[model samples]
Target: MSAATPCVLVIDDEAQIRKFLDIGLRAEGYEVLLAADGAQGLALAATRSPDLVILDIGLPDREGHDVLSELRQWSHVPVVMLSVRDAESEKVKALDAGANDYVTKPFGIQELMARLRALLRSRPGEPDAPQRYDDGHLMIDLARREVALDGTSLALTRKEYAVIAMLLRHAGRVVTQQQLLRDIWGATHTQDSHYLRIVIGKLRQKLGDDPATPRWLKTEPGVGYRFLTDH
Candidate 1:
C-alpha cells in the first residue's frame, strides 16, 4: 500500500484473523499492517503512526488493556478492541482504558467497517479540526483568541482564554493537569495545581458553565479535563 493511504494496524496473534482483516480492510480501501503481539504492536504504533489500530485482548506478550494503557500515555490514535470474549465488563474496561470502540469475534466485517468510518470521521487532525468553534450559545475564534457567549463577547483574562483554547485543541481527550500546567503556565508551574484550578474556574464562569453540571467543559476528577466535542 502507498504511504498516503489510510493505514490500519491490526494487532492479533491469531494468523487466520489477521489474514481475514488484511483482505477485508484492504478491500475497504485501507492500508493494512499486522502485528502478532503487543510489543510489536506498540513498536508499530510508535514508529508507523497508523491512522487506526485494531487490538486483540488476548495477546501473548501483553494483555490488550495493558497495551492500550501504555499507548494512551503517548498517542491518541483511535483504537478498536477485538476479542472473542463478549463480556460486558471487558468492554467497559477497554472503553475506560481509552479504546475508541470494541468488537467481538465472529463479527461482521461490514459492521466493523461502519464503526471505523464513524470513528475516523470524528478523529482529530487536518481538515477535521476547525479554526473556529461555535456551539449555539458559545463561539470561539481560535485564531483571534476571541470568545463570545450568547452573542456577547466575553472579556476573559489571559489565563482564562488560554485554558479554553488549549482544551478546544484537544477536544475529546483528557488533558492531564501536569500537561495543562506545563503548556498554559510554565514548566516551573507544573507543581502548582491551584493555578489550573483558578484558571478553569474563571473560564467556566466566563462561559456561563456551571462546575456542578458542565455544559461545555467537563472535569475528569484528579486527572484533568476535556471539552465537549459534540459541537
Candidate 2:
C-alpha cells in the first residue's frame, strides 16, 4: 500500500484478529493501524485520524461501546463493529450507540470488504455550493449548515447539525446508528449511541416534536432511526 493510502484503524484485543485485518486491509491497498484495546484505540484515533476504524465490541481494557462514546466527543471517522454476539438486541444496541455497521462473528471477508467499499463511496465530499431541502416547514441549508423550522432558525451545535443533516439527506429511510455515526461523526464513533440520543433529544425539543408522538424523527425500536419527511 502506498503511504498516502487511506488509513484504517483495527481495534481488537485478539492478536489473530488484528493480524487478519492488517493483512486483509493492506492487501486491499489501505494503510492499517492496530490497537489492542479500547483505550489505545481511542488514543490512536485522536492522534492519527484514520479514514476508517474496525472495532471489536469486546476489549480487554474497556468495553467497545464506551470507547465509541469517547470517540464521539470529538472525531467523526467511520467505524465498523465486529462482535461475536449475534442477538438482535445486541445489534440494535450497537447501532443505537453510533456504529456505522456491524458484522457478526464468523463473517466472510468478502462481505466485510464490500461493505467497506460501499461506505467509503457513499461518504460526501465538502459542500462547494449551498444545499437546501424543504418539505414545506422543514428547511435545511447545507452550505450554511443550518436548519429551520417553520421559517424560524433553530439553534444547533455542530454535532447536532451534522446528525440532522445526515437524516435529512436520507429522509424516509431507516438510517442505522452505525451509518449515522459514520456520516456525522466519522467511522471511529459508530458505537456511541448516547451521543445520538442527546443530539436527537435536542433536535426534538427544538422542532417541538412530541416524544410521545413524534412526527418527524421516528425511532425504529431495536433497529436504528428514521426521518419521517411525510410528516
Candidate 3:
C-alpha cells in the first residue's frame, strides 16, 4: 500500500463488530488495525501511530472515555467513538473528552465512511499542508515559495514567509508562540515572544490584516496564533 493510505485502528471488544469494521474499512481503502480492549488499543496507538482511531465506548477492560483521555495526553490523532447508546449526552461527553466524531452501533458503513473522510480532510495529524492556498485576495504557493496579494507578489523576508507558511499549514488551529519560536528561531529563542510578535505583525500588515478585526491571523492572547481560514 502507498504511504499516503490512511490507517484506522478500531478498538472494540465485540468480535463480530471488529470483523465487520475490518472488512468495511478495508473495502473503503483504509488500512485497518484491530484491538480487543482499551489496553491493547492504547498500546497499538502508541506503537503503530495510526492516522485515526475508532474506539468502542464500552470496552472489556475499561471505558473508552478513559482511554481517550489517556491518549489525548500525548497524541492528537483523530478519534471517532463507537457506542450502542445514541443519547445526546453521551455524544457530548465523548466529544468533550476529545473524540472527533461518534458513530452508534448498527451504523451504515457509507455514513461512517463519509465521516471518516471528512475528519481526515481536516485532521490535525496530517503530515503536510496542501501545495497552495488561495483565499481570493491572498495566494500562497508553498512549493514555489511565493506569496501574492491582490494580484501582485509581495516581498516577504525569510522569517515572514516562515511564520505565514507555518500558520497556513496548521490553519484553523492555534500554533503556540513557543512552538513557532522553537521551530523557526530555535529552542534557545523560545522565550523570546517579541520576535514572533514582530514577524506576525509584519505578515499581517503585508497581507492587509488587522489584529483587532483580523481577516487572516487571530491572536490567542498570551497563548498563540491561529490562521483563520474562514475569515
Q: Which residue pairs does candidate 3 place in steric collision?
A: none
lDDT of each: 0.87, 0.80, 0.88
**What TM-score do all the candidates reach, one by one?**
0.55, 0.54, 0.55
Judge candidate 2 at residue 104 and give its lDDT: 90
Off by over 4 Å in 2: 1-4, 125-231
Q: Write the per-residue lDDT of candidate 1 for residues 102-136, one digit (tens) a residue.
A: 99998999999999989888987643555788877
TM-score of 2: 0.54
Which candidate leads the pack in lDDT? 3
Clashes of 1: 0
lDDT of 3 by residue, 1-231 (tens): 134799999999999999999999998888999999999998777655688999999998999999999888656889999999999999999999999999998899899999999998887645667678898899998999999998899999999999999988888766778778888998789789899989998888898898999988999765578888885
Error of 2 at 3 (Å): 11
lDDT of 1: 0.87
